[model samples]
Target: MNVLVIGGTGTTGSLLAKLLPHARVGTRKPVRDGQVRFDWDVPATFGTALDGVDRVYLIPPVGVADPAPVVESFLVRARLVRRVVLLSSSAVPESATGMGALPALVRTMPEWAVLRPSWFMQNFTGDHAVAAGVRDGEIVTATGDGRIGFVDAADIAAVAARALTDPLPHNTDHLITGPEALSYADAAAIITELTGRPVAHRSVSTEELTGRLATWLPPEFAVILAKLDEDIRGGAEDRVTSTVLDVTGRPPRSFRDFFRGFLS
Candidate 1:
């Protein structure tokens, strides 16, 4: 099966691309020869790359307030494809974002699965804003003392691969999560233990976070993120789910292990 992986150079997408045997890895930049040209913003590029694809891993456009229209357009042409798997967030419903409408979109086909993964553990090791905050010895958040069950990107990728290759899809949305939940302070302590840096988790107002994020993110998207943080504070992401283990046949990695291996 020819699996077309959108956002194939990103954290989960890249990992999923490498796991699949016959995969077409899509990229916006011309990173190398044989990389398929796929950009969610450009509708003209979708057809050529989607041609002859048996299954697809759909990733919505980044920073766009609404990705439904773009994704809907692509799926219209990709109807011939047998299956599609979408990457979504666990906090989407609480934040009431565009991703909340995606499961219905995926269900338009016979075989489909939606993976709603929690905040990635990569937020610390990777060059994300959270990582920068950690490096600066402070991680600011509006999440107060609420806990998060942050899953690893690799675990999410493995589950995606399984969903794509399965003869009969699970045919439902799966809430993928880590084995345990931890507060930001817990994560900060783990970082301190690993890197010997006294990283602290600072509490801030949602409005403050929203304004600060607006400097980089679009205004609407910034507010959406701030709302999700508020949801986190309300304990939206505090539960652990067995979906990763159920799909991938192994428990998801913990945040402590992620920090230990990456920092060591």
Candidate 2:
């Protein structure tokens, strides 16, 4: 089946693209063979990428305040496609104003699946925070003693690939998480064990974190992140779910296993 992967170069999207080699990658910039140029910010480019595509692995652009218009527009243009598998976050509840719209749209599709995965284990090694922490031997966050069920990006991608390739129920949401919940301190300890370094997990005040993030991200995004940290600290994402095991028929990878594979 011909598939289109939005954000094909991103963390989860990259892995999904690799898993679905026959899938067409949609990006804004010029891409190599088997890849198509498509931009979420530019609605004009949606048609070329969606043409003859049977399935889509949708990823909303990062730091977007209003994703509904973009998603709705894309869906309107790509009405011919059979499936649209959306990559949503566990942080976005069905009731949240900004985050709820896409999932709502997916409900109208002929066949769709929404993946609500918890914090990715790759944030420690592949993302900005983790890379910076690895370089400086310190991981700072506003989540004080909060446990998070950090799911692997690979597992999310596996589930997405399966949902896209096989027959599945439409308009379904999967809350995927790791096998266990761990705090930042626990993650730091695991990283130290893997790399044999003195990696410290420092708990910063929400105000301090917001200030630091303001230098890089927009103020609204910074505030949202700070609130999310508070939510995590409040034990909102500490629960482990069976969705991963139910869908993949295998236990989700633990944070320790992720450390072993990625850090070692």
TM agreement with the true structure for every prediction: 0.96, 0.96
Backbone clash numbers for all candidates listed: 0, 0
Give the local distance difference test score of model 1: 0.87
Steric clash pairs (candidate 2): none
lDDT of every predicted structure (CA atoms) = 0.87, 0.87
Instruction: Tell me the tens digit of each residue's lDDT in model 1 across 119-141.
Output: 99999878877899898999998
How well is each residue in 182-218 modelled by candidate 2, as lDDT tens digits?
Answer: 9999988988888888898888889999998999999
Most TM-score-accurate candidate? 1
Report lDDT (Cα) of residue 205, candidate 1. 90
Model 2 weakest lDDT span, ten residues long: 93-102
